[model samples]
Target: MFAPRVALASLSGESDADWAKACEHPAGAAFLGGVALDEPTREAARAMVDRDRDEFLPEDPVEFVDDQLSALDDAFLRAGVNVRTVDLDPLREVTEVCASHDAVLEVNAHCRQDEMCAAGAGESLLRDTARLCEQVETASDAGAAISVKVRAELPDVHLPTLAQAVERAGADAIHVDAMDSRRVVRDVSDATDLFVVANNGVRTREDVFEYLSYGADAVSVGRPSRDPEKVRAVYAAVKEWFL
Candidate 1:
């Protein structure tokens, strides 16, 4: 989906400036959102959007989402950046918005937050493989190049099995938050034809190379992207290694 082999993973507080910084880098792709699709997911997005406060009280959920998407579109979409929006909602609700904006739709199954999991929207999906596959198929059917972002190490969840299921369900790519287990990326890559994007704990060029060596088609930088200089360093390292 991206020309470079490096990507900026979805992070909190992804403002227009954040997207611009990512575009300034040579990273292959930049993923925005991790936005809530429903009440369950909304709680988490509320926390991020209303940080420093203990509670989130929105008068209208629909308007809240519309406003959020509008602000994001205004800030980042026009930049011509290859951006994808990660969402916690079902495919049917989020697909059209993505298509309307020409943004790639990424289904998030990697979040470990209690609220999201309780709502059956995040890591909880890992255990519900059937439903996860259904979501991917729905997005793909809607003509979006779908990507499923999954977390590794979920109890009773097999990375390869999930990866293959998503691939068979028509997902274009699988973004794995390997979480200390690079083997998950390797196994997922080996098990599916879908493009594999490896995430977690990537700090240096060597970290990027290590994931690629482990069979990741792309490596994602998360926390590091908060610092433009660090992102630039990674971009420089990737260029040196790949070019």
Candidate 2:
């Protein structure tokens, strides 16, 4: 949970320590990376790059995570890493680094890329809630605070049901990327006690207020995160609302 309740969401290839730093002025937490953690996911990321997309494809994924987090050693705000992997082993490896750094390990189930879904990660996890819950439990067992980043409005995927299962699996938070269905935040929040961080289209104070009104514990800035004025606006909205 963050102070002013504004988090900087992970942007495909650009989210790193420097990106986080640039957006951290008024954010309580920064969820960096949607980093590819295993060979399968890395392969998918590479394929995405082939199509002119961006992704974090480090040679040594876990080590890269450790280094990125270490760069935030003196940061005043909380740090979190959103990770992608089809294998549990790599996820466990990254979770250890997150735990050591006292950072939240966010399991990425929000990405809608065809490449990611084919790799059995990203939005594919939404279709397999059981696998997603297992990831949350795996991260928690590694001594990391767990947050599952999920997308809304996926076909045949009941978010409220998924949220309850994730909570039971030991996730401390659920980051909801509510794609045009902001009310989904309320559904997830009402379904489970997991801290809900609502995301998508967050820019102004009104945007922040709308998500909070729908039961989000926090709201995150995605595309507009690099804009100081937009991030500051959400920060001010949080401060004012909580006052």
Candidate 3:
């Protein structure tokens, strides 16, 4: 009910117990952290389900989103969690799958990972506004609130224009990954009208203040390593600040 929501991206694992630990944090409403598809074995996924480390289920881009949603349904109760996924061509497959599970759908334009970009998801969408609008319209038309997850642009791009276009294209929210302070950093105030959700390169209570100061409706995070308490704290903070 906060102005913005806090969610975790790319969560994965082979064990329900591993997933239970992450669910323990109330702020982690949506979990997406996972290991590479080429390595979804229990041994590799243990970091995600057990240690709460960032891991993805080894899967093709679209399949990865499906796999995560499937695992979430099998791993947790629907009433307790609003699950979701991120992948390439999610409009082609993953979104339908999410609707079936009554899960939320997210388009990750923030992943700067080389392997992910090559797959044609994440930040690559930013490079092609035409495709970006297509993806947003596709998901939005499906009765889903398309969340455009993007990182701060390279020093050369127009940040405000990019943020505005996402909203103009029917995106319900804008996810700004502020991991590279030197490169991709967003001032929450820059996003007008759009629900600006801060993400990435964030691991502390103070880091969250940066978002609120800039008028971010909410913030998302995955740095469980920085502090096991961080996820819970963020969730509580968003509700406290906005709701």
The TM-score leader among the candidates is 2
Candidate 1, 180-224: lDDT as tens digits: 788888888888899898889888878878888878887777778
Ranking by TM-score: 2, 1, 3
List the candidates' TM-scores in order: 0.80, 0.98, 0.68
Kindly list the per-residue Cα lDDT of model 3 for residues 1-243, writing each as its tens digit: 222266554433332224434643454345343323222222334433454544444436455555556666653323111222233244535556656656555665655544455655456667877777777767766665556666674665566677777777787777676655512334434555876667775555666666766677667665452344666677666666664
lDDT of 1: 0.67
Per-residue alpha-carbon lDDT of model 2 for 46-96, expressed as tens digits?
A: 999999998888889899999999999788778999999888998999999
TM-score for candidate 1? 0.80
Local distance difference test, per candidate?
Answer: 0.67, 0.90, 0.54
Cα deviation in Å at residue 212, candidate 1?
A: 0.5
> Considering summed lDDT, which 10 consecutive residues are worst modelled in model 3?
77-86
lDDT of 2 at 87: 89
Q: Rank the candidates by lDDT, best first.
A: 2, 1, 3
